[model samples]
Target: MLAYILRRCFYAIFVLYGVATIVFFISRLTGDPVSIMLPPEATVEQVEQLRRALGLDKPLIEQYGIFLANLAQLNLGDSLRYGEPALRLIGERLPATMQLAGTALVLSLLISVPAGIISALKRGTLSESGITVFVLIGQSIPVFWLGIVLIMLFAVHWTIFPTGGIGTWQHLVLPAVALAFNMIALVTRLLRSSLIEQMGSDYVRTARAKGLLPRSVVGKHAVRNSLLPVITVVGLEIGSLLGGSVVTETVFAWPGVGQLLIQAINYRDFPLVQAIIILLAGVFVIVNLIVDVLYAVLDPRIQYK
Candidate 1:
């Protein structure tokens, strides 16, 4: 298991490298940052001099080499627009993203677990039908749209919460719900299906035939086996959310990594953009590695070679 984990950590490095490479090139292709930086009436000389100062005058290959070399030393360079270390900016914004993502994850799990189990237990009944409809609607709603609607209802008309920005729990309510909407539906449906399938499995039948309590059989045996897929979704969702839910963050004006990324892209801040993407890719790789480790714990049948 340790060897497997070490191998995955090794692969994670390549994943981060690929992400950094792609983002570095793609950011440049969007447009030259110097163009936006200078005034319209600026002379060619001013643009060229500014480019040289920013090292944009260097060949693309040389820039890439510099980027990789900096990356080796864990240096993400400075944000072009912010005039601060890119890594430092990311660190400042990370806690906000973490707060939002954590709230969303908790909301998703709180709503999904019981809903999924009950929906499975009461299959072919009204409760199941209601849960199905709810999941369908939740999945169908676009996150950005949901965020706007929630603001209108909860913040504008009702005045129950602040419309945007972050501070208290009131400010968090709308955006978190909007971000969690699809995840809740996705987890609930996945868990429901998995539990239903597990209920029909041979082991489930054996547990029943042995006169075990129905609740125990369902909870201990079926739910445990059904959880692997749920865990995978949860792991991925947390990573994605932590990376930043761009739409939800934008809608709520939440000062998070997602909002920062949008600004960075708009300004073509290459160092900041690259830093954010690489960090997001690293989060995904680490979360997936954790999920793989959990598989062995959840089901000992899964053994690392």
Candidate 2:
């Protein structure tokens, strides 16, 4: 297990480096930050001075080398727009993004797990059909549209929650629900199918033949075995939610990393953009590694070299 963990950690370094390289090069292609940062009436000499200050006057290869050196020293450099350290800016927004994503994940699991188990156990019944239809609709709707409709209904019409921004728990409700709706559908459908398959397995039949209660057979035996795939999906979705919250955060004006990322992109803030991308990519890699380790924990039969 230790060896396997070490291997995964080593691979994660390569993945993060690749992500950083791609983001860095692509951001440069979006056009010079000097053009975006400077006023239209600024003099050519002013532009030259700003360019020199930003290191854009240097060759692309040299800039990339400097970027690598800074990364090696755990420095993300100063934001071109904010004139603050990029990592510091990201750190300020990280907690809000984490809170939003964590809330959404918990809400999704709470809604999906029991619903999926019930739907699977009661297959071909009215409840199962209803849940299937709900899942289909939930998955089909786009998150941005869902967020808008939610705002209209709950925030504008009902006035039950704030329209946007982060403050009280009420402010979190709409954004969390909007972020979680699709994840809930995905987890529910996957869990339901997996549990249904597990219900027919030899182990399930053996447990039943041993005179175990139906609930015990389904809950203890089948559910545990079905959880491996569900856990994988959940872990991956959690990572996705962190980065994918861009649209939801924008719609709701939530003060989170996703919102900050949009601002950075709009201003062509290369340092900030690169820092956000690298951080999110690292988060995704770490989450997947945790999921891999959890496989052994969830299923004792799964052995790691």
Candidate 3:
């Protein structure tokens, strides 16, 4: 397992490098920061001087080499807009984004797990049909639209929660629900299908023939086996939660990394944007690695090679 993990980490380095390289070129294409930073009335020499100072004057290859060398030292550089270290800016906002994403993930699991199980167990019942309709609507609605509707209904009409910003628990509700909505639908559908498939397996018949109770057979054996796919979804969705938080945070005016990301893009802050995207890509890689290792934990037959 240790060897397998090390191998995955080795591969992850290449993945992050590729992400960094792609972001570097793409960010440059938005036009030079020198043009935006210096005033229009500034002389040509001032423009060249500022460009040289920022190292934007260097050739693309040289700049890339410098970037890679700086990245090796864990230096993400300072943001052009905020003049703060890119990583530091992200760090300050990291907790808020994580809080929002984590809450959404928990809410989805809390709701979806039970809903999926019941839908599978009840099969063609009204309960199953109702849940099916809920899932359909959950998946259909846009997160931003849901967030706006939530704000209008709960915050505007009922005055139940604040429209946006972080201060108390009330601030979290609207954004969290919006972020969790699609995930709840996705996980519910996946788990329901998996559970249904597990119930029809040979082992399930054996458990029934051995005189196990229906509840025990379904809850203990079938549910446990069905969890592998659910685990995969849950793991992958962490990154999705962060990405979706972009929309949710915007609509709700949440002070999270997603909001900061939008601001950075508007200003064409290359270093900050690159840092956020590459770090997010790294997160996805790490979560996927964890999921692969968890497969062995969930099912002993899944040995790491």
lDDT score at residue 291, model 3, on the 0-100 scale: 94
Q: What digit string (tens of lDDT, one per residue) describes model 1 on residues 34-134?
A: 98888999999999999998999999999999999999999999999988999999999989988999899999999999999999999999999999999
lDDT of 3 by residue, 26-123 (tens): 99999888778888999999999988878888899999999999999999888989988999999999899999999999999999999999999999
Global CA lDDT of candidate 2, please?
A: 0.93
Lowest lDDT block of 10, candidate 2: 235-244
* Candidate 2: segments with Cα more than 4 A from true spot: none
* Pairs with backbone N, CA or C atoms under 3 Å apart (clashes), candidate 1: none
Model 1 TM-score, 2 decimals: 0.98
* RMSD (CA, angstroms), candidate 1: 0.9
Output the lDDT of residue 304, model 1.
96
TM-score, every prediction: 0.98, 0.99, 0.98
